[model samples]
Structure formats: C-alpha cells, structure tokens
Target: MCLQIRDIKSKVIYCSAVLLAVMLGLGTRAYGDQLPHFVSVHFGDAIWAGMIYLAFRVLLTRHPLWLSLVLSLCFSFGIEFSQLYQADWIIHVRSTTAGGLVLGQGFLWIDLVRYTAGILFCYVIDQILQY
Candidate 1:
C-alpha cells in the first residue's frame, strides 16, 4: 500500500541520517588528533554523542524524543564507564582501530558533559525539523 511505502521511505531516510552522523563522527575523530588539544579532545566526544543519539533514533523510530535522548545518554555513558575495565581481551580489543573507537582508551568526566551537549543538540535539531 502507499502508506506502507511511505513508512518504509521515512525509515530509510532516518537510517541514512544515522549512518551519515556515524560516518561524520568517525571522520572527525580520525582527523581530530591533529588539531589543537582542546578541539581534538572535546569535539570527538560531542560528535560521538550525536552519533549515539542518531543510533537511538534508528532503533526506536516511534519512541518519544525524551526517551530517545535518555536511551542515548545511558548508552553513551555506559560505553564511557565500560572503559574502566581493562581486562586482557578488552584491552586487546581496544588496541585495534575499530575497538578503540567504540571502547575508547580511557575514562574522562569531561566526556560526559560532551555527550550531554551532543544529545541536547540532536534533540533540538529533531524538534526544529518537526515544525
């Protein structure tokens, strides 16, 4: 039916946006290390949070904005907190490029603030788009 097709199209668009955010986040982090210390440190974490928000949107297409934001914050903070564990296997995984990006190398309280900012930014963007 036409309605089904429209729904599918909307989902595709949402997924694509998520993918783009993830790619941009990764790209920024990949090059960010070369920038000044402050920009390199904070920008990646904020972008990572935005990527997390988009990921939640992709997974929970019909969920309310607040729920998505909360879920994203929880997921981002969970990953950040998980860095405290340095088991052999996890350490080995973190040594690799993909694993390092996902797990991170160390814990930092500032990253939490960056994540909150990123999630809030995404929420605002979503709200604007709804108008």
Candidate 2:
C-alpha cells in the first residue's frame, strides 16, 4: 500500500510536468507572432520560470514548496546570468533553437522581474490547489 501510494504520486507529478511543458511550448510558439511584443516577451519568461519550478517538483518530489520555489528562482536566474558570458562554445550552442530557448540570446534585468512574477504565479497556483 505504501509503495502504491508512492507510485501514484510519481505518476501525478509526471503528468503535471507534462502539462506544464505543453503550456510552455504553446506560450513559446504563440509569442511574438500571435501575441503582442511586451506580453509575449514577459509572459514567455514567466512560463520559463514556471517550467523551472515544475522541473524541481518533478525531480525532488519530497521537497517543500518554499525550497522548490527558491531552487527554481536560483536556476532561472543562473540561466539568465549565463547569457552574459559570450564564450565561443556557449555562443555556438545558444545559436541553436534548443539552446536559444534554454540559454537565451542575451541578458536583461527585466527577465529577472519576469521570472519572479512567474515563480510567484506558480506558488499561488500551488497554494490554491492544496486547498
């Protein structure tokens, strides 16, 4: 019975991660073309933050919400800061579509704000669902 519960929780977490990924993909594709410039840019960052949070949840299922949020923020900020470095290999990787999405093309202070907003949004949603 204990093992069954753990299995169910794992499946639920995996499903939630998949749902978040779908939302992130849709937001990424819709941005710039279907959405306004400002909304697309900031919202995309928010979704990226949310994805980071979901990733933490998927990997560390036993972690507390606060820990997950902090780790996610740290990771998102780290990626954003990494964009400031322009090494040849990193630049080559960032040139690719996958790398562009993961590493980003350039650094922006506004992205930090967007990431905070996104993580906060996820936290609120998590709290709501808990009730």
Candidate number with greatest lDDT: 1
Residue-level lDDT tens digits of model 2 in 1-131: 99768857865875676586658656676666777777766788787788788777777666677888899999999999999999999999999988998999999999999999988887787767657
lDDT of each: 0.83, 0.81
lDDT digits (tens) for residues 103-123 of candidate 1: 889899988999999889988
Pairs that collide, model 2: none
User: Best TM-score goes to which candidate?
Assistant: 1
TM-score of model 1 relative to the true fold?
0.86
Q: Model 1: residues >4 Å from true position, as ranges?
A: 1-3, 33-38
